[model samples]
Target: MAITPNYYETLYITRPDIQEEDLAKIQQKLQDSISSNEGEIIKADKWAERNLAYEIQDHKKGTYYILVFKALPNASKEVEKHLQFYRTDILRFITLKTTEEAVNKNKASEEKKEKTEPTTPTPPPAAPPTTTAAPTPPPAAPEPPTAAPEPPPAAPEPPTAAPEPAATPPTEAPASTEEAKTENTDTQEEGGTN
Candidate 1:
């Protein structure tokens, strides 16, 4: 039967006072153990040193390292056996079976962190040119002034009030055409007789 490998994550803490060389040696030993057990490591990184929740082996602070690998269950047990017995610098350790999805999620989060981390300083924006004034020219000879052109005449002002209308006698119009003709005939007859 084909054996299915299982993913595992191991978080191990070391003494805060451990030397760099000693720490590297300790890491190398664990890695060697994992490899010998036919396990393949996916990620191995050191976490920041910090105060521990509770002292282990009288250590209030420790340096943490994480190791994620895929291997047969028997192979993982072999690796853990080495950690539990052979290693002395390790103050505490925990190994847990994990899903491939969790491993991918962790990988993505680490990539995101690296991308957001600041890089080398960028050059500042180019500065504007300096403001020192250029050399002034020598004074020139003054010329005689000529007559200035006059502006066009202004438009006439508008009248303030309109003129009063001419006076005329008020006359009533006849109510009908027949009435108007009778009045005109009477006036003409009167004029003729006079």
Candidate 2:
């Protein structure tokens, strides 16, 4: 039986508040630890600052880094322990065992892209030649007639309904004086009969 090392990819994030010098020191520490543990690093990159999907350890943003390496299982554990216990600048981290083929594939693609891209920066476009003659001022565009702005047409009024007939309260007719006298006399005659 032969012991074999495994490939791993570790993605870690550091607190955004740290200075660039401090960040460099952290990366150096990780590299040193990996080497000390007999781990061979294949790739290491700082991914720059990014906003976190959610805050971790009171940090809403963090600088990300990725490390890919081949190491014995125990060696990987040691690296993780170093980060988990010693690196307070780090906000979060995850390590995943990956295939060597995947790592090689990614490396190959990156190399191909670099080779295909242009290396030299194109020169800035030459400035237009300056003329010594006084440039004729472009004829002032005829000032459009300055007619006073017509006021916006008043909005059409909503159609009004026909005025409804006024409601009249029923009124009682007043009794004539002659009619009142006759009614009183009839009441008196009835009283006399009773």
Candidate 3:
């Protein structure tokens, strides 16, 4: 049986606090592991730090790295095992087989778009007339006849009390304290007689 090389993409996140030197070391180790397993790396890129959709291992953000390579099916397992050994450094990881045809298609489409797109620089706006002409004063309108100054406004009167609202008849009058007590005694007496 002939072994076929499969294209795979691995996306992994490292702890946010990892130093640049340590990060580079991790990347080197991953690349070495892939090469040792007879895998060829197509791209290894750091996608920069991003906020996680949800916290992982107390991490609110992590540095993302993607590795696209061609390897045997078993090589993916080996790579994943190697990454698992460095659990403390990595927050999460996922490896998936991808079709080379899809990648090629995307590249061709991007190239086509670039070729079809126009790159004309926008022309700067036309400048205003350089010659400064003296502005003419607007024609003066006829002046209105002057009137004697009116006396100052008189002091405002104090506000009157608000009108009382109309009283609506109550459905039932409240019983006085004495009446309530008598009613309570009558109920008690009736209960006793019963």
Can you tell me which runs of candidate 1 are displaced by over 4 Å?
Answer: 119-194
Angstrom error of the Cα, residue 6, model 2: value is: 0.9
lDDT of 1 at 142: 21
User: Which pairs, if any, clash in model 1?
Assistant: none
User: What are the lDDT scores of the predictions, listed in order?
Assistant: 0.67, 0.67, 0.69
RMSD of 3: 21.0
The full ranking of all candidates by TM-score, starting with the best, is 2, 1, 3
Regions of model 2 farther than 4 Å from truth: 119-194
Candidate 1, 33-142: lDDT as tens digits: 77776778998888778999998888899989888998777756776776776356788888999999999999999888888665423332222222222222222322
Which structure is stronger by TM-score: 2 or 3? 2
Best by TM-score: 2
lDDT of 3 by residue, 1-194 (tens): 98887988899999999888977877787787778777898778786789999999999999999888888787788779878888888989999989999667756886787776654232323223322332332333322211211111111111121111111112221223234445555666788899
Per-prediction TM-score to the true structure, in the order listed = 0.56, 0.57, 0.56
Task: Identify the runs in model 3 with alpha carbons over 4 angstroms from their true place.
Answer: 106-194
Better model by lDDT: candidate 1 vs candidate 3: 3
